[model samples]
Target chain A: MTAPEPAYVAVDWGTSSFRLWLIGRDGDVLAERRSGEGMTTAARTGFAEVLESHLAAVSAPAGLPVLICGMAGAKQGWVEAGYLDTPAALADIPAAAVRIPGAAADIRILPGLAQRDAAAPDVMRGEETQLLGAAAQLGEGDHLVCMPGTHSKWVRLSGGKVAGFSTFMTGELFEAIARNTILSHAIAEAGPISGDNAAFRTAVTRMVANPALATSQLFSVRAGSLIAGLSPVDAKARLSGTLIGLEIAGALSLVAEGTPVALVVSGGLGTLYKDALAAAGISPAVIDADAAVRNGLAAGARALWSL
Target chain B: MTAPEPAYVAVDWGTSSFRLWLIGRDGDVLAERRSGEGMTTAARTGFAEVLESHLAAVSAPAGLPVLICGMAGAKQGWVEAGYLDTPAALADIPAAAVRIPGAAADIRILPGLAQRDAAAPDVMRGEETQLLGAAAQLGEGDHLVCMPGTHSKWVRLSGGKVAGFSTFMTGELFEAIARNTILSHAIAEAGPISGDNAAFRTAVTRMVANPALATSQLFSVRAGSLIAGLSPVDAKARLSGTLIGLEIAGALSLVAEGTPVALVVSGGLGTLYKDALAAAGISPAVIDADAAVRNGLAAGARALWSL
Candidate 1:
């Protein structure tokens, strides 16, 4: 347990975030680094340099084989890791990892999942790793996994195989609507929304009952403030609830009745989504998203490098 | 049929627009004026002076009575012409017009309609006047009138009485999502969306079939661009269709199956909505919103003054 010597590096490089962890041979973190130098920034300032700088910061061992996930593998990233099409096996991800060229140390970026159906052609870059990790705890079964973030991913897994998934612009839409639309005036001074807030619960119930009225319900936030004396906090809560609730309804509609749902999330978002799901009478098993991603990277490392 | 002298002025003063028509005793427009001096602008430059300038521009006679509608009657406008609660008669709207006090002329602003139910509190300002105007053509039956704009109002009218309504944040949301969200990248170079576009029609049909997946459908625009090589035009069309379709679905849900639907719209928005409704298996009666507002104002003027 004496920190087992640094064996490999695991990185989750997203759109606007970069996280790197130096993992020991025992599959435990020996050192870690996080920065805003994600794909967008690295693409401008050199992806290889960004990786090298972070590696140097943690005093990594020479020639450490790094396994990366998320946007870093996108077409616009360092090297396009490409996508492993649907009905894909979680076991196949490590094999599809595209290796970065001209690097002294070994570095491989994991492939994303893509649903190539014409009607609902979809793609996910990083969440597939989280899904792989969470699947370990989820075990083999018919499971509905909701990984909430900027682009919330709702995945359906059947017997350790990926069936299909839908990404809801829940978090991003909430920001755009609140800040860019007229709802800004209604929720200008509001603080964060919690699960127990009555407005949040009510909004969730309303969306769940009749999600077709989602946009109409959004306008009610403004009208409620203008005429019905709805408070700013309540207005924000209502907006959050409506978006989250709409997502829940959509995800629920795709899955069969009585199917077990699980929420893989981290930090404050975890509590908020837990409350939102609860509003829809769903109590999903919670999984730490941070740990899930780390565990996913570890699994990839073990599969690839035999660490 | 000799041209009658000007008797009164009818105005539709909205949030960011102002339109005035000097009407003759025979219900003809003697002189018309339009400006950007809506409530928002007039509140800064002076509502009375803006009215005086517009009236002077149109050579309105001295002491000419004026009937106004829209935001000019809001709490922060020229005067607070409070809302007439729902189940209100169109004929009674003129009686409820709050007269501007101490003016040389008899100036009045018509009251908006408010559905004061605690569950779904809603309000409509200027559209009530359009409803008043369109009511003449609508006659005596159940009608679902849709006035599409920044805040699209869907009215449930029965026997010339304002029953209830819902406002969908369709237009505003389209702009917000298109400009502020990641979908912006997908639709950056796209031109305006037309009704006949394949992507637009298909999106409308999808939403009408499954409104709960609205946000997910939104994300598909981006995914479609990335994976399916969807054009920028199609991306924009899909966004527009999803919102329009959602609105139609919500409006249809509130009324009976066979209730006649009408589109009270002006300019390019008319064709888009007509096409959207068609996608929902609805052929709404089209009413020119411009004429509707004028007729509504004239109706109010005739009721208020014995010209």
Candidate 2:
């Protein structure tokens, strides 16, 4: 009989949150766990302690190799894996396995991607690997993968490589503007991700028609709610729609108009994005981040063993 | 003896800075003084102390009437001049004025403009009066006035009335993204405001072409400087250009295209904006904000006396 196959663990460590999955040799997740002990908070409690505490809740072989993505490898995270500049492929990933001092397992951190385009000055991180993972699963094709989050990533994959990618601070801007700035009063505390509010959709469509008008249009959300009797929830939805739509309009410009783009959305706001994309006449292939992260980790783990 | 005309004082009291101008019967600034003392800082040192300190610096008539604008009239300012809802005209400005209990002179604080457009849902302040001031000077015509500052305002003036306006957090966003975020390394401590840099212009044009792509492009400023040898100053300029260009493109969409727009830029960045606008094929009429403020204050003072 084949010697007992070694199990593995996968982690997606983000800015304000953390997720872990214990997988069997066959890639089946045996256990899962998450926590608010993200990269920012983990810095306070030594990285090693946080990792151990989280791992203590999950079961895996003593020496099982673990794969991790997201901010876990950021400068302020458990171990800085540095960055792998863009126009990169799956093989370009830096797999400098992070050895946790006094920990129970073997761990390998994934390196984020960075790139500099002569046409414009910009770079990317974290999402490059996820795009690579998506590319690996899809095999070969030209598709647009949009990962919406605090800093949303709109990646272009061509022939199994990240040809180019762009990021939008849509989510971060939303949070900052809504909570920290003047628009806070107009937005609701909580609401459904999608609703049938014409005013909200109209505001979004207006922005799409003229993406640059976003900063000004944001005020309209509050004005509508206060002066035109728009409900706070609806106003919030309209604000969300306007921002996301502007981002989409911006991201769509990088690709050939009417290209066969498969928008692979991976984030908590996936549902909202899907609706917005639909409104824009684009049918997206929705990918639950849970599965994508696992797939990405498995691909990364496979690549490491093969190397 | 043409009793020494009791000139009115016009003040634009902002969050962290203050500008007070003693104006004569005509729209001429007799004396001007500025201070680091603003509403945000004044909160720490009581408003009365800050006001008195500024008042002491400029010795005007014994009981000159003062017309104030900006956060000085906010809820947290020295006195709260309740928000004036939209569709409000210059004549409709509230007279209640924020009552500073023990001030050296009688103060008549001008109310900020508020609006609730059906299309959008939010109100505005201070800038509305400036737009009114701009309209007051520029006369009746369709024009877009971009006032760049901590919170930049882009107002539309038509038929000598304040049609509507939109605000962009360009200055605040630039500050946050440059100093606080990952792109901090790209910015320099100081640089020439109107450097003739092609990279900066190119970045602005690219942003104009795809406004949504900024979030991702921001990282390149750092990467280009680190790997491709882009000077920090040039990188900073490019970053500024990208954000501002995106804003201009957005603002332009709100008005008729190719409709002979005049960008009346105010604040310190006016020179840089003038250069950028020139590069973008738009001729802007640069206004001396000091003069405009004096004119505005005089007009408000005259209006008060007429009332």
Candidate 3:
């Protein structure tokens, strides 16, 4: 078997990092490339050059169709692919792909999802593609999808249509609070927090019990370390847990009671969020976020070029 | 009708500020001096020298005993005054003042307050003195006192005894999030938020309604600006309002409903907290924090040296 002929290239280009996967006709990942050349860098160095250089390294065939997702489709990115307003159908995302004007290949960027509610206006870029792929496994009925990241997005999906979602500034807030605030002295190294940590689970439990005391609980990190000699690791864990717990509590509030939930995540944060959810009495159906995005790009490719 | 003779010198030396007041025999402020020579600065410039220069400028009588509070008493301050454990009487705080050794003048610094519960161990330095003076005016009964600052402190005063207190990282979190997170783009300049702003009151109301949605609401500040044309002023207001409202919610949760609350703030944050509290449906009696600390210092001086 001569390694199945290459079909297309799928890219998840985020703010500060770029990832591209070459796919075979059988939907297998033929070759892959990862880089720090995200939108911020590509916008300066030229998006077309960045993409072509990666493609050349992977030895892609000339003029092969490429499906792009994430910030690369932003107004400031390679080519503007505006947002598809909710409640948008996941299947229709590919048809809305914005094609590059003068690119050599059939390069198209996927549109993001925008919730235009007057009260809670929100937006998402690459996560739309991830959700589109993840939604394939999540068939029928309603589901609360958790896509944890720097800004954790909780989406409400109904029958393959995007209803609405909320973005929680949990991870970003955790980092800022840990680095810039007085709590910096408590959690010294500012290391990665563990899910199995008792302080982590306890923080989640406390937030679920009374989410109002969040900032106060944050103060407890400093105070606990000062008065109670709380270990640095526990301090970091509690800090991480408080933000994650608050995120879960806020997300759960928007959904109907007992709505099936799916956690689409990959790596360490996956475990951290899982522990936080368990601490909040939630056991989510897990999906690999990495695979979800790849599958999403594949779906887009299949629609755009019938590859 | 001759000029009043100076009796004692009162100082409220905080982390980043230095304030000195010359008090007459009749409890009048004869002369005042303020500088940036707080604990963080005084430690390098010599706390004794910093105090003496201000005292000499005010022509404070030689050997006139000095009453100091705030970070001047921290271990990292001029000299560690330590902390008075909870259930401590406000009247008893004066007796615990730690004397500054090897000083030309008879100088003393007051002790701070510490809540040592296992789950919620907390500490406070300068605010304890403010609480001491504020308690005198409160005159018995349980009062939830709000002292808004970089770290807002809510003291539970019960019958003139320091019951317990909580410190919220509200003000600090607001600054950090506004400057460090992605929301910074939404709230340009991050100017001081107004209490009278509609967005501010709305944010406070929302937090009071569902404190769980804090981080999500924070994201709304950015999304609101991105999709809904939310103004920078309104964006900043929402950010400030969200943190302040969460603080009020947390403080209220720790107390019995309808506890007589008092706002002990000095500057702009006073109006902000008042508006936020009103939005939360509570009208707290107000106290000027600057005066509270001065009054606390006077009380300490009278108790210490019968001035």
| DockQ for all models | 0.84, 0.39, 0.86
- Candidate 1 residue spans exceeding 4 A from truth: A1-3, B1-3
Query: Which 10 residues in a row give candidate 3 chain A its minimum summed lDDT?
Result: A185-194
Q: How would the docking of model 1 be graded?
A: high
State the lDDT of candidate 1 residue by residue for B1-307, as single tens digits: 9657988999999999999999887888888888899999999999999999999998888999999999999998999999999988888999999999989999999999888776677888999999999999999989999999989999999999988999999999999999999999999989888999988999899888889999999999999999899999999999999999999988888998999999999999999999999988988899999999999998888888866
Query: Please, what is the TM-score per model?
Result: 0.98, 0.78, 0.98
Model 3 agreement with the true structure over B120-174: per-residue lDDT tens digits: 7889998888987787788899999999988989999888887899999988998
The order of the candidates by DockQ, greatest first, is 3, 1, 2
Clashing pairs in 1: none
Sort every candidate by TM-score, greatest first: 1, 3, 2
Give one digit per residue, the lDDT tens place, for model 1 in A120-158: 778999999998888899999899999998999999999
Give the Å shift of residue B248 in candidate 2.
1.3
Candidate 3 versus the native: TM-score?
0.98
Model 2's DockQ score: 0.39
Ten contiguous residues minimizing lDDT sum, candidate 1 chain A: A1-10
Evaluate residue A234 in candidate 3 and report its C-alpha lDDT on the 0 to 100 scale. Answer: 96
C-alpha lDDT of residue A181 in model 1:
93
